[model samples]
Target: MNVKNVYIAYTNCITPLGFDVDSNVQAIANGVSGIRLQENSTLMTAPFYAGVIDSDKLNTAFAALSDAKATRLEKMMVLALDPIIKKSGVELNAKTALILSTTKGNITVLNENAVPVPDAYLHQLAQNIVDFFGFTTQPIVVSNACVSGIMAVSVAKRLVQAGLYDNVFVISGDEVSEFVLSGFNSFQAMSDVPCKPYSANRKGVTLGEAAAAALVTINNSEAKAKIAGDGSINDANHISGPSRTGEGLVRSIESAFNEAGVTAQNIDYISAHGTATPFNDEMEAVAFNRLGLNEVPVNSLKGYYGHTLGASGLLETVIGLESMARNKVFASMGYDEPGVSQPINVLAANLDTPVNCFLKTASGFGGCNTAVVFQKVNNGR
Candidate 1:
């Protein structure tokens, strides 16, 4: 049996910075950040910085898709995915699959008297989107902490490679709700200012909201990037904190590199999961250094998008694909100086260099880490 090659055919994103992939890339290129000081007392007692989508703008865009009522997160997800599904022109049939990745799906509904609503359930949230699109197959949900997005991509690759489906649509999203804000505030992890990844003065994470979509298929024609290899590992070091030695991350990257049949030198860039949290940035540095990737040009998009929870991994991966297409590496926003103990070449400015292959890594709560390697198809349209 021959293993099929997985390709990312189409991608889109909905965030405060922009509604589509090109707009988001242009915003990053211009050094524009969506993270801002939010002063909504309903979400928090004091003002906090976050990357929040404009409800009015989102509603206006969603209105064109459907007039039926939907949650903020569902709307964003649909908006991000609608174009991909339309552009792919793939028929919704048994051969097609839908996978939704989110850390908090309609979780805001629980804030209403602390009672769980039907939409609050992850499956129900997926079902709503499935029904909207009239998907014939049952929807698959991926909700594994912050790594959910990239993990969903990894899952899609495996499914297509297994011949279970010709194509899989992966959508990931999370919102900045009172619950999310309070949860991070309780951990004392909410940064007052925009989060700075791998910065000496970095404080903590600034919560954000976003939705991203990608079409994973065996088709290489007009492919954006090829999913070469993937690996996921859990260190079980802590329920909330990552391993001090970056054990899980190191293993995950190594597994991905092994599967891709490539070494650190082959990787042109790295889109790191720089949450801007002290421990996470330090842990990633340790992991990259352990794998001899100390000199790889690495950057985190968290500074521009803040920490978009479940959407971060996929959102960043979409940006990485654009970087490869353009042969440019976007700077790691908010990085002033190296704060981590190990030596890693964190991109300080936009670099115009060849980016044929890149690595995407994400670490979430419960010590889970995922790494995926993607390469540009030489003949891609």
Candidate 2:
């Protein structure tokens, strides 16, 4: 397939730190943590904090849409689209593709008995967004666990490369519900305090709810972040766990570099998937070191955005692009002490560096991992 030119035209996010893309970038630049105790009684039952969107504001935004029975994910997808469609100045055409990424699609509607829970969840999500926007093309929903968002971008690029569509809208969103929160808690992975990824005092994870959307196109335009290269792989070692040695991550990073025709030395900054859990952080450290990228300035946005689960990959990618454009890398907020033995350089202070190429990676529960390489306009060597 031809390697099509893909640009991230617009990104919108809803996290505890901020709602729009600009606000989120500013919060990260300031090393602001988005995790906080859930003020809602419904969310307060869980011990850990989350990067939750403002419910009242979200509801207000959702209510403006025409669909009366739109699910939470549907609402979020709508919210994500508003900014892009508005900013692009390109009218929402029927030919534009809609590629959605979400592991738990509309799990919030299951308890209400408003829909068939798991089986029809994904279909509902796709159709709801398509119907709302009145798109002529069929909607594609990718449910690849945590790697869904990154994979969505990869798929869009492939499609455009093959000359299938000119525009692709990718949305990644998931809500924090009893089912998801309890499952993580049962695994004893819920952090009582805010999550501290890649830190010596790191404990467990804190669940976060987030919605992120990016607009991409084959057309090279002035208003988007270009997609340089991307890679993905499966561990095949475990079904619901990451490899202890981070073997899959290593391969994925290598593959991404190869696709970009660049080497490890070319990446100046790495947006790592630092989940703060013991195994995840250590495995990432080993994987990064093995790839000879140990000295690369690395920071995990999990400290700022908490783990947005399905939305983590894309949300972090957005942050990486914004940081690179501004030529500033922010420190990992929750890191107090070093955790791993490997010589990984975790950012301790925001640094002004000439960032050219960046690698964004994410590893999920299903032994899936992906890496995406990006370069600034006129910045690639």
Candidate 3:
């Protein structure tokens, strides 16, 4: 692939922290948290907090479609995508490529039946989007667990670079359901309270439901950031666990750097996939220290976003670019004491820094991991 320029035209996200890109960036800048305790409920019966979007507001905004037979996951995807689609002025048609990413796509339907596998549930969700937009092109679904969003972006880049499509619509979403909650409960990975990433007293993860989308193109003159290079690699060590020494993550990072032709010191900020889990955080620390970037500002939006699963990688990368435009970086909230023995400088407060280039890393199940390097285009636009 001899692609030179890739642009993120616009990003729209619905998270517990903020509703849109501007508000989300503000929350990140102020070091605000979106996690709140969830009361007893049939779908989610845990004491941990979550970053949930305002359902009432969403319902009001989408009231016109109330008569339609749209699932909650589908509604959430449209809600996150409405703003960007409206601004892009790009009609949803065969000319547009739709790449949907999710870990558990509309699994709530399966929970209602309990007679089908996860894959069946996913195909149905893809059909919903294709029908919603009345598109003739086949919808491509990527389900590489937590790295799904970044993987979706990588695919979109390739398709555009290949001239398969001029505009790519990347939508990622996952909703809270009983099945996933029970699975995490079985793993004993649900936090009792709001998650505290990189903190010594951190408990576990608090799953969050969210959807976000970005319009990608080869010639987006209004992009907030440019996609310089992206790389993905599998560790093949464990399907559900990460490498202890962060070897896989290191490999992905090296590939991203080589693709971007940028060195370690060129990276000004890192949006880590700090899921607050014991193994994940420890592995991230090792990766950062090994890269000799222990001094650079490092933080995880998981503290605020509460780990949006499939939507997280794109959501965090969007925030990284927005923060660069704003000239400030968010601190890893709920982080006071270092949890790992590694000398990783977990940011304690928001800092004003010149961010020219940033890196986003994600590690997920199936030994899948990805690293994407983004640079701010200084074309004086």
Q: What is the lDDT of candidate 2?
A: 0.80
Q: Each candidate's lDDT (Cα)?
A: 0.93, 0.80, 0.81
lDDT of 2 by residue, 282-353 (tens): 889999999999999999888787788888888888788877788888898788889987879999889899
Candidate 1 vs candidate 3: the TM-score winner is 1
Name the top TM-score candidate. Answer: 1
Judge candidate 2 at residue 70 and give its lDDT. Answer: 69
Best by lDDT: 1
Each model's Cα RMSD = 1.0, 2.4, 2.0
Off by over 4 Å in 1: none
- For candidate 3, the clash count comes to 0
**Residue-level error in angstroms, candidate 3, position 209:** 1.1
Please count the clashing residue pairs in each candidate, in the order shown.
0, 0, 0
TM-score of 3: 0.94
Query: 1-381, model 3: which lDDT tens digit per residue?
Result: 456577777888877766688888877777777787766487665454777776777676567644566767788887777778778887766668888999988776654566765434676788777777665788899899999988888888878777888788899998766777778878998888778888998888877888889988776577777787788888879988899988888888998899789988999999888888899999889988898877778888888878888888888878888778876888897798989868776779988889999889999988888998888887664
